[model samples]
Target chain A: MLLKPKTSILQKIYLPDIIIGLWITIKNFFFGKKVTIQYPEERRNYSSRLRGMHYIKTINGVENCTACMLCPTVCPAECIHIVAGERPDKEKYPISFEVDVLRCCFCGMCEEACPKDAIKLSNIYEMSMLKRSVYEKDFLLEQRGHK
Target chain B: MDFIDWIILGIKIGALLIALLSVAPVMSWVERRGSALMQNRLGPNRVGPFGLIQPIADAVKFMFKEDPVPGHVSKFYYVLAPLIAFIPALTTFSVIPFASSIEVMGRVVRFQVADLNVGFLYIFAIAALGIYGVVVAGWASNNKYSLLGSVRSSSQMISYELSMGLSVIGVIMIFSSVNLNDIVRDQGNVLFHLGQFAIPKWGIFVQPLGFLIFLITVFAETNRLPFDLPEGDSEIIAGYHLEYGSMKFAMFMMAEYINMATVSGLLATLYFGGWQMLPGMHTLLESFSLSGSLSGITYEWVRIVFEMFSFVIKVAFFMWFFVWVRWTLPRFRFDQLMGFGWKVMFPLSLVNILLTGIFIKVM
Candidate 1:
């Protein structure tokens, strides 16, 4: 059962109430500060820890990744594929690294799992692509993200 | 008519047509921008400076778009309906006086297009014809939703029009004239006698209850929000104009906005002081003119321009009010709308008329 509230004579005549409503709207229209941030010209600051685009951290001339297979092991989507090979300077380095971007959920687990802090998820969220993209080793190493 | 008179009339008609045509698209921009302002956001600021030219761009886009008629619909009524809707909306402005009469080129020129004795009735009768367009479009569409929308619109408009018509009776009774020009001229009189404290006899002051009723019914008649059951997108999926596209759709939109403009014009002319300014404003302007900033014929021209400007401002205020109300109120349920119209609005209008009658007799 529904209880209908008894309306007073003043309430039944809705003009006064409508006037009050109008007053509130007019006040807001003229005085209330808008919250819109125009995109392209303006951007919101994301946290440093935001799980965005994947990037391979580099220092000096060499990549930080030693290809321990930890990122691939921990990746929930199993998107990461690495083929470890020996180099002159490094005992283990990835000869090939691939990440199927569509399959990856950007959970930052691979970043967490990387012992060398090599595979970092940087604060670069715009990842729209015309076609399906798989991140190659050279492609992932580009300075495309804010750390 | 003489050659000069015909030329003057031609100029007036051309100016009026252009003015009426431009109001709809400008209102479209204002509605978008104003609603955005109320909701705390920027709307359409890219097309031009504050998106002023956005409506022009929109019209251009509508022109280029392909208009495909559905195979199932009746072709004749489908084509005719938009013209039917648009013509009446445009024509209703003919009877409305924008300002008091002024002398121009040695001839007295009234601001209105046609000063028929049955001015208000002409407005009502022309406005009433708009329902036919909606009904015809809906029926011809061969779509159930469109039919339902048209039915709802027709019934709502028909119902609300009774109260709307009745509300105007009070104004007519008070003014003792159906000619809108006379009604406006009458409004320039002092409202009441109170030892050096005279009020302007605005229709709003004289018939507050009638004004309220008229305001409400205008919203319903225009099929605006809180009374937009006919075109409720969520329920009826654009109602009567569901199958329409491109220029046809644009015509319907133009018709709706022009209806809004007409209502705003009427509201300003009837309740507000029409072209008449606030009590001291005209005297202030006259005093300023006497101070010798402008002299002779230029002064008359200045006054005429100022009066026209004031009329535009009054109409614009009511147009802004329409947008403000649209953004503020939620749509009403059909049953509740009908109930309110009959139960509340109808009886209240009668009481107002009765009281107005008694007041007129006593005084």
Candidate 2:
């Protein structure tokens, strides 16, 4: 159904409507609150559950991973790689752990698949880089994750 | 003219040219920032101090950029069009008085470049000539859109000029002078005393309808938004200046802003008491009491400075008003623009003239 807007004589003349339009703009110009965040100086807070860059969880200078290879098996992108090895203090540890960050889908499935809660996603979203790089185990152990 | 008179004329011309030229860059910045503010966004604040130097940076970029001449365009006329458009826009300011005359060294020095007896008429004539540049650019570019833009521009200007001229007829009737300075001086007279306060007989009070018509027509004359059909970006893709780039395009942009400033000055001079002190300025000047303290030459200088300051303030307000209106109203459709110009503004201005004539005859 088509609807026709009712028009008055004053509306037809248009001068009053123009004046009202101008008044609205002037009010916005003088009193309206600006919505710009001035990006470099300010940043917006995101939800804690946001899946961003990946990190490895460590407690008391030891990783929570038992080298169970669960994360690599569950990752949809097949980006994660791990090699289990025996260490002097631990029965099992990963000698090599790598995440091909460029292939990351950020699904958070690897975090869920890890039985020991060793692999996790953080809220640090600024992951831009000049060169493409894979996240190595040493770099991932920097404790950059908030959760 | 004597040697001193020649020197004074040279100074006036130089000052006016400098001020007019600077208005383009300054207004570009103001338009960007003002529109941004109106829309609740911060525009171009990354350059020097709220983007004050942004236009200068843009000018430098224009200067350094490659100015390619398209092979399809007519070479001579294409190069000549911007100059034609620009010179007339700059020249229209000569007859407009910035402030009243000051007696310097026993010889009167006016704040105008040339005080022509037919001042406003000179403006209309020169402004009409600016349309040639648009038409020539459109034709010379050898493009359909450019030609269409030029055609629209010429017709729009011609249609609106009639009403613009007719609207000011009321002002001329009330002020009884063609000279802008004389008209401004006449506007300073008190219309009536109401208790302790008196209202100055500005052109607006006497010819409200004329003022309204003139204000609307000035928008059309300057080819501003709601009347900017010539450069309707969505329609014709920048219209006449589509083929122009680098400094040539800059020249057209400069011509537009300068024309805006010139017409804004004209609007203030005709309607709002040009060079007359604003409402509270008289009391402010009285409180200073500089006339009693300062000597003859000094007092005259002070008075001239104050008047010039008032004129600048009025012109600035109108310039900002143009920007305000531009951001507020959407562009008019081509048909709506033409219809409004002929059917509405034309008849309204005619009625304004008839009413003014009757009022003058009765009084």
Q: Best-fitting candidate, measured by DockQ? A: 1
Weakest lDDT window of 10 consecutive positions for candidate 1 chain B: B275-284
Residue B284 in candidate 1, Cα distance off native in Å: 2.4
Give per-residue CA lDDT, model 1, range A1-147, as digits (tens).
899999988778776787888888778789979888998899987787788888898888688999999999999999999999999998999998899999999988998889998988878888898888999999888765666
Task: Compose the digit string of candidate 2's lDDT tens values, residues B91-142.
Answer: 9988888889888667888888888999899999999998898999988999
lDDT of each: 0.90, 0.90
**Candidate 1 residue runs with Cα over 4 Å from true position:** A144-147, B292-296
Clash counts per candidate, in order, are 0, 0
Candidate 1, residues B1-363, lDDT tens digits: the string is 799888877888899889888987899999999888888888889998999999999999999999999999999999998988989999998898987787877889888889999988999999999989899889989999999999999999988999999999999999999999999999989888789877789999989999999999999999999899999998999999988999999988999999988988899899997888756668878897889887777877777777788889989998888899998888999999999999988998999899899989987
Query: Each model's TM-score, in the order given?
Result: 0.94, 0.89
Q: At residue B214, what lDDT does model 1 achieve?
A: 97
**Cα RMSD, model 2:** 3.0
